[model samples]
Target: MRPDAVVIGVGNPYRRDDGVGPAVVARLRAAGLPGVTLAESDGEACALILLWQQRRLAVLVDAVRIRPPHPGQVHRLVTAWPVPGPLEPDRGSSSTHTVALGDAVRLAGELGRLPARMLVFAIEAADLGYGAGLSPAVERAADKVAAEVAAEVRTWATATADQGP
Candidate 1:
């Protein structure tokens, strides 16, 4: 069944701090809110685009490497973001291939497959090396983000129910 809402974490758990997204999803899974789907992707854009298709909302979590090192900072970004438009990478950069999460979001926008309401929770990355587990800063951020995203899912569920299915 198509979920009413989804939380997709885009990152590689094997790669240190980059796994923050998946970590957040892991927590959400344990929370087990009805009508919500939780998933993890190894920083794959195409998979994400397909996951949220026809959904009412999609909340994406990802790790970003940036200057000044604000490790573990949870950035709430994007809500009905204008896609198919120019997007200069800000806050941080996705440690993925040339086509990163931002590009994937734009592609979804261009393809008109974006959700009715969408949001991105970007975490400042500390380490992205070949290893398991997140850095201290990122781990804390992931836990915090998981709670916030869960709250969002609850809110969406309530609102969706109020609208009468």
Candidate 2:
């Protein structure tokens, strides 16, 4: 059976703050929201597309490296399905992924494989250096972001249920 929604965590845990995505996923896993699938990706475009295909909603959590670094700031963005056009990566921030999330969204749009709705939660990073754990600020942000994602999933589920079969 298809899940009502999927959350994709895009980042490398070994890369310090880049691990925020996986960190958020771990929290959601513990919350155990029904009918919501959770996945971790290296932020590769194809892998991301596959994770979200056919779902009603997709929520992506990732890390963004911005100049002069804010460490733990979170940014939320929603992309309309059948995306109007190719999305440019967030201004002043670069993805920690090999392929930017915007690129994946564009590819999915072109392939006609986008989910009905998509959300991105990008956390600013203080460090992308080789390391096994997130920096202190990013860790705190992870907790906050996890709660936010859980709330979003619950909201989506409620709305979906209200729509009826």
Candidate 3:
């Protein structure tokens, strides 16, 4: 069977690191993988679930605000997100309304609509003000994260191919 998967780059381009996800999609387009479908999202739950239907895997990329160990760190989540508490509303740039990427996955699971496997790439942002440009730090980090996302995609494709019946 052919491998079926989708990579969802989730963010708004004008909002610093929030653009990382979309940027990855653009990079992947240039890389030209044969079997994968790419979708650009605003991290909206409806759009993600719709795009992910029946796919073996879905990779989501976006900007995040992490705590302590590395307040401003780029990170990846390769499995289900740990359950979170009530979401604090965002004052700056985020691509969705009300719910977020993490919550969406959880909600999907609740609704029996979750994908087979899911992964997330989240980069720390220095700023998320109303703007069309990225901070120097976020810009550089996006390039690195995009490479990582591409490598992960290649690995997923290879592994899926190897598991043929």
Candidate 4:
């Protein structure tokens, strides 16, 4: 069976600041939040669709490249849409991969595999170089995003419990 909610951290740990998503997941897991299923992905769209199928809620954390260069900025948005194409595109993505997070979400929507409520926590990355560690800015943002995502998980869990079986 699917989880009450899933926290998906999407990133490539080998690629410096691109690892923000996985970092966030690490923090969340360390804190041991209840009733939350945590997952890590390479930010692939089709794989994301598989991770979030038939869930009450899904929260995705990833890094994005923003204009004006607000590194470590956290952008949280809703994504449980019935239609496709509303998600932002990856034309400006910093991932080494061609398929970006927004593109992945849209593709999942097109396939009708979205959960009841999906939240996206996209962090503005400071660097995407081939490295082992995240930039200081991105690391700070990861901590912040993890806390926010954890709170959202708790909220979802409480709501589900209230609904009853």
For each candidate in turn, give its C-alpha RMSD to the true structure in angstroms. 2.0, 1.7, 4.0, 2.2
Candidate 4 pairs with clashing backbones: none
- Could you give candidate 3's per-residue lDDT for residues 3-74 as a string of tens digits? 577888888887766676787788888887668888798877888888876778888877766433232356
Sort by TM-score, top down from the best: 2, 1, 4, 3
lDDT of candidate 1 at residue 13, scale 0 to 100: 92
Model 4: per-residue Cα lDDT over 1-165, one tens digit each: 556788888889998988888899999999998777899999777888888888878888887876656788777878756545434423454533578665676677677777888888878888888888988888889988888888888877887789899
Off by over 4 Å in 2: 81-89
The alpha-carbon deviation from the true structure for residue 72 of candidate 3, after best TM-score superposition, in angstroms, is 6.2
Candidate 2 residue-wise lDDT, 23-65, digit = tens? 9999999988888999999988988999998988999999998
**What is residue 53's positional error in candidate 1, in angstroms?**
1.1
Q: What lDDT score belongs to each candidate, Candidate 1 first?
A: 0.81, 0.87, 0.70, 0.79
TM-score of each: 0.91, 0.93, 0.81, 0.89
- Model 3: weakest 10-residue lDDT segment is 86-95
User: Candidate 2 clashing pairs?
Assistant: none
Clashes of each: 0, 0, 0, 0
lDDT of 1: 0.81
Model 2 residue 74 lDDT score: 87
